[model samples]
Target: MAKDISVPFSYTKDGIYYFERRVPRDLQKHYSASKIAYSLRTRSSSVAASRATRAAQQLDEYWYHLRIKGSELPGKHLLRMQQNATKAPGSLLPSEHDDNATVSQSEAVAIYLRLKGQNRPVTFHRAAERACGYVIDVCGDKDLLGYSKADATRFRDAFIERKLTGSSITRIFGTVRSVVNLAASEVGVNITNPFTGVYYDRQSGVIERAPLPADVIKAVQRECMKIDDDLRWLVALISDTGLRLAEAAGLLREDLVVDADIPHVVVREHPWRRLKTCTSARVVPLTGMSL
Candidate 1:
């Protein structure tokens, strides 16, 4: 039998935990969320619990604020400008209903860019902005809390219209969602993310990278043998050892264990370049033209 799975503010599926809730219909207009099925973005239940607890705290405060305001908060649940003159003598003011921070999608993207800028490359930041730009274009500007499943659906349809592959579309959605989620969590914004469950069509549209044909490799090798430059050696090295373009370009003379019992190329980080991942740092056995 399947494991009996239950938690106070979360649920598990496929080894990942998700925060789930059904926003009361009367309160949905104010929160701008119908249902919350946000992935805590973790496989570990403990981590998911921590994240879910934070989300739940925010939601609880929202519910409390709603009850405190009673029926005074007006029209389509929009917070109207203060009308002190029209108010009952001792009624609670609109100011009292200011329960959460309100950030527009544009403003959130700016914050995301600023916070992410120092750590990541400019190209990465630019790509993130483009991804966010597409979202704002499709969804229209709204407060963070105002994003909904309808917006996600619209964005998905728009991407499909553009003929973007499922992987590309999913990546665009996921990037913006990640930015929003991080910003909301870090900046103490109380919002339910619509993009969490709006992932792209899975796996099918992923185009796998294939290796060069043996004849093509041979043709390149024959040509590289004629050129007497670093390009020639790079072509030769990859042709035989299959080293990544960066790994070959970033190589140092010391990284070549040519004198060892079994010659190898040590794919390690250098002052000029770092391995993309820890696993990228390894010893690749050398042979053929690479020797």
Candidate 2:
């Protein structure tokens, strides 16, 4: 047998050619072994080289797909049903007597929004829509009951491929689970949400923020008090009350209650801005240079 540069495999003394390639680090978890190895069963170098080239090309295409499975699909939202201004809850769901009916991923999004989006902010609706849209983009709009645990795992892997922060992916999964759960219950279908229990590293690639040290905060506050200008006032206010930048920036004039026994600023939802969480809507007493 002649040595062929085109042959990317090893050979044994018995003249059997074998193919072996290491699995990429990111995709290692999908396989039980670190490397894929197989016997080509060809003693002819020409045949072995041809076989190796084809196998390598196939693997390249597969790995490329795996890396970009979560990429945004153009016009994925088109798959969704158009919103009905007067549709009642469960209107979009399949009929109770229609045992043959199946709810698709798009229908689930519409059903969830119609039922849960009442009086909710636009962000709420968009979040649900975007999350479900990802499913349709990556896995097609399959019937709700058609999803298996493997599909859920694939969805998770797609998010990883997209480089979404763990927290962001977790929120996406939460929204998807809610949509599927609501759709299943409203349609009187007995099905479990496939998005549940799909584990991804919740803190992977997350850079934790550390709070400012007491001395640093004090120094900054001291500088703010010395300047006491409009710009510094904003910084001082945040330093004292710990209000988020948006929360403080969007505060209403009426939110300031200086005449009260304990002067405080009301942090509540506004049309221009919404509280980060329900508990974020509260009153914080003004103190230090904030007064």
Candidate 3:
């Protein structure tokens, strides 16, 4: 019955919890309303808290997409002119009159999502939309077949001009390529995906993550023990088990195999939380406080 202070929720007469958040001043022009309010539809505090967190995260991602869409890509003018020059003689941009030429890039994104987005995480849909949106912003949304290797090269170059890390640029190309490939296959079109095999330095401007020193980890664990609160318990759990924050948080009580020969925890995807990688699902041995 205690209120969760981390998530902002208000109660109604019926004990239903709801949340309201004000849209930031800069992003207000994108919405007709100034705030977002929605019912969590649950009286239980825990359920309401979870729902509130999810809602806030989704809104943040949506706002991020809007900002990305509104901002001009670096070197966009030069990229657009180059794309126009490289187009084939009869190729048409996706204009009001070009609906029947072929499946446009934006349409390809839609088709890709509709076919492959079922039960996928929100990031899956966003990645496709963001990548295709980048291309559209730089080179104009043309027919799927209209994009040549030159266009793909230009897209990569635009990201470079934007100072995005090489890995980030490669991931964008991966999403764009998948969308184009799936759409072309579904429509029985024989067009090659120009986004494929676009070369970029995958390590340029990348900073590798350094693990915490052993002494630091041990000191943190000691401090966690001294604090001995729910949050510290979670930290200790992660420290010993090497589980990601979301992975450990999403674990069910039954996921711990304490009575087995080797005490361990099973990490897997849940309806509320998805693993970052396909191979992320594994059994991690527990030690120290996690045991």
Model number with the top TM-score? 2
Instruction: Estimate, for each residue in 1-291, the C-alpha lDDT of model 1 and write its tens digit.
Output: 112244447777787777777777777655434666655546776666666676667556556766786533321112221334454522421133566655556556655655566646556666776777666556755677888898988989887776788888777887888778866765565667888786567674578999789999888888898885888988899889978898999998998999899999999987688677769999999999888
| Clash total of candidate 3 | 0
Instruction: Mark the regions of model 2 whose C-alpha exceeds 4 Å error after superposition.
Output: 1-91, 226-228
Q: After superposition, how far is residue 207 of candidate 1 from its true place, in Å?
A: 3.6
Better of 1 and 2 by TM-score: 2
Local distance difference test, each candidate = 0.68, 0.76, 0.72
The all-Cα superposition gives candidate 3 an RMSD in Å to the true structure of 16.1
lDDT of 2 at 9: 52
What TM-score would candidate 3 get against the native? Answer: 0.65
Off by over 4 Å in 1: 1-97, 203-206
Ranking by lDDT: 2, 3, 1
Error of 1 at 204 (Å): 6.2
Give a tens-digit lDDT track for model 3, residues 68-125.
8652111111111112234442232233454445677766776676678877987887
Pairs in clash, predicted candidate 3: none
* Residue 279 in model 3: lDDT: 100
